[model samples]
Target: MTKGSVRSANGRPHSTTGGRPPGRPAHADPSTTGGQMTTGTTATTPTGPAPLRRPQWVRVLLVMLRALLVQSLWFWVWVLVPAAVAIVLLDRFGDLDMSVVQFARYGGIWYPFALSFIGVGIQFTVHVANGLTRRSYIRAVLVTTLLIGLAYAVLMTAAMVVERAVYTANGWAPYTSGHSASLVAGAGSLFAATALAFTAGGVSGLLVGIAFYRGGALRGFLALPLTVSPAVVVMLLTDDVAAGRDWTFPATVSTVPLTAALCLALIAAAATAFHLLARSAPVSKGLATS
Candidate 1:
């Protein structure tokens, strides 16, 4: 045998190349190796975070409607319960001369209470919607709360009309020209109430939605002013009007129109504030994933 070549016992020349063939291992390559190396280097990187999604306007509206529906039903129950109890107590005690129209007007006093509950419900709905969609916070709050408030106003008006008709038919009291004026006043009241309620609710919902996104206790505290400011103003105005105090000459000319305009302006301001606040809030931490 030549010195350069070594022969095995089987007579085959010994190979010069050492180890495995020139190719990737079963689990290794430039692409695969690079990937493994990169993964190992960034092992601390968090996983399982969900990507952010934009909210759909229509879906947000639907969620709001569903929430409002449940709230409205509960409010109706609340009103009915009190009225039933009053009727029973009155019947048991004596044949009270109070007409159905009077009872209906009295029942209308519960509107604010019912509205407050509805506002809370709407806030919750907006929070959920914001969580799911991470939409423009202002838009979500305004659209949802405004629609709910409008619907509530319409329902209350219809109920008032129905109650009035029933009372008139039952010979409780004849519908007078003054009643027509009163109805017009009531309509103005409804418009004002709707605007104020919607504005307050929208602001509340936006704040709550921000809380849901940011994870803080401040939202709860902020919610108070957002909801109560408009309410307080409306109450004071209504009280003044009821007391026959006219601070503004224009307002005195037609109290209803003036009140309605003021209420609408407040609602618009609230909506604008909600939108601005939402836009200013930080993006949700959990929603920052790519």
Candidate 2:
């Protein structure tokens, strides 16, 4: 009937307001189009900054431990594979006088000793630069040192046991190069000696690491006896329960338990000394000023 108007179905013309009610605005919300609320839009709840989380030393220790293990994978591969081959070849052809397992013992010690230096020399600066506290890094390293030493001890002991079996099967003697006659008499004794020695090496590494880090080359050199004494003493003690070759302590007093206790005490002392040195050690200007 009229422009912009539509007729109802009953044959009567009803005006249309362009499909919108006359009183409603053109840009009115669609939710109120029919006097009813629609679920057409979503509301976002405001969020605050993520809650601060304290740094976890356990996590740091695990991460550092894994990194150390991965980094040393090549070392173990090189050492174990070649050493195994050499043992077989030497036994097959050469008249070997001593056990080849002894090499692994010394290697187990020296490798951890060397690794300790890197743990502090590089990791300390890296941790500091990354906003980690020195105390946290030190604690992680200390725990990692113990764990790695134990791991090496288990590996070395297992190798020794396997070697002993092979030697026995071939009618060869698995004679250790240590001064103590009973060092390799039993698997338990062998493991104890290995664990004690390796742990001592790790702790000694920390001592020397902090020493060199805190002091320059000259000072570190000067402090060698003090810093390195723990490892040396433990190694010597493990080698020979007696200070004198002619004089030996009574078997009851020179038990592995006593030896372990003494070695643990020495390791604790070295670790304590390292903590003291590291606490006061200044961060190198080249690494991290703060």
Candidate 3:
């Protein structure tokens, strides 16, 4: 019956405390909140080393690997859909001469190169926003880039095996020969080149993304030629790849003066530039200074 008192069920007035009760959580535990039942998470986002914590590299690797798998799956589908359409059309009209291995090989180079932005453009922003260091994120991305490149190459080689069998079964021998660096190796050299090309693409993509992150759309556009140069160098390393493909290199690259060493050097240069630019990159709403 008091002004600020509440009546109990038994009809007795109880005085109000005017404060929250004890032994109650103000917010849910982060781990249990979103179904993330992680243990020993002392804080909302775990920072440095903890006795019960997993290694940062391990966590970073997992995030990178998961992203790679997701991207690679969709990428393979994109690669295969066009390939399937082309195969059907070519086989139907007897234009199977347009090699499937060669067609798919281009994807191995281009997808990773273009998708490399996901590393810095998307993942980096999220991770950095979540309190990760740029240095650690870049290192993890490099590792992921290497892995994705290797994965792209390996998948390419496997697809080639299928192409070879199917093409030969269809009485297509000309395209079946595939690319050999020399008389002894057709698949070996192809695999290595595929891996290298894919790797170059991934790193180049990463650098392109870094440029945009640091400088915005205008800078990204300006960096396009420099970013694409590595893939060009890789393509021109030998006559094995892009020899019979519809795509052509820049007219400035008059001759195939590039070598394996030079191609590697270009990839290394792009990767190094990305590292230098990104090592101290700041997360901001406005464009960064490169």
Candidate 4:
């Protein structure tokens, strides 16, 4: 209890310096066991989520798919619904040369195409931050693009069919525009043409988005032909103007099967190119953080 002496657990006098305990080395670590040197080793738990398992990746894909599908829903509500209404109104007032709904075909291509750009440019960082891998995000985007395209095709083909029926009921001739004037040969041909064109748009948008995202301005500019070619091919093979222009291959591939095959080939190629580019593309710190 006096200077240089402290009461031990047994009430005996224990020697001390600055109230240090007896029989303890001055430099000894409290963390170590008796007479054992401490290395400060610890079992490290990962800071974020666990390494992404197969099931986790699948869940992530589903979540992303759901979000994208919701976006598509809004697009259809805002664009397709109003377009359909306008077409019916306009057709009632006067005689029209072509199916007004046919013009909505371009909407099918451009809307999803623009959305594909946003999927990569804006959504990738968010996806990663949410503890998902880029691979999973890319897969989700790809699947969503295809699904959106198919949905557009179904809706557009149905609209055209309805418009044709209305035209017939009114004792009028129905014609197609943007696509081949002869495109509405059958429901099968119409669906295939719309599906291929819409899907091509989605894939072309992906190609453009990845090019700009991964390669910066110069490279993206240089890659424009490659990035934009899918949409161009679809337009050339399917558009009425292109058909009117007398393109050589356009004439040959104007049939339903050839058009479908060509469009599918373009979509496949563009999607693959996007995947390859995006897998190794650098994430910009400023952009990601911003």
Candidate No. with top lDDT: 2
lDDT by residue for model 1 (1-290), tens: 54555666887666454434235244344586655633323346567887776446566667667766786678667765675566456556865344232333223333433443445334434454356443543455467666655665565556555544654565442233333213434545544454454344444445444444344557645675654455455544554322213322245567656776775666566556545555555554443431
Tens digit per residue, CA lDDT, model 2, 186-283: 66666666777888898899888888888878898899898888888777666542211211222564565666778889999999999888877777
What TM-score does each of the candidates earn?
0.53, 0.74, 0.68, 0.71
Whichever of 1 and 4 has more TM-score, that candidate is 4
Candidate 4's C-alpha runs over 4 A off are 1-54, 175-183, 240-254
How many clashing pairs does model 4 include? 0
Q: Per-residue lDDT for 210-275 in model 4, tens only?
A: 888888889988998889889878866766422222222445645555666777788888989988
- The C-alpha local distance difference test score for the whole of candidate 2 amounts to 0.72
Clashing pairs in 1: none
Could you give candidate 3's per-residue lDDT for residues 48-160 as a string of tens digits? 78778666766898877986797789988888778778787878887566455566766777777777875577766677777777778777888888888888877877776
Indicate the worst ten consecutive residues by lDDT in candidate 1.
240-249
Q: Which ten residues in a row have the lowest lDDT in candidate 3?
A: 242-251
Evaluate all candidate structures by whole-model CA lDDT and list the values in order.
0.49, 0.72, 0.70, 0.71
CA lDDT, candidate 3, residue 220: 85
Candidate 2 runs further than 4 Å off = 1-55, 175-184, 240-254
TM-score of 4: 0.71
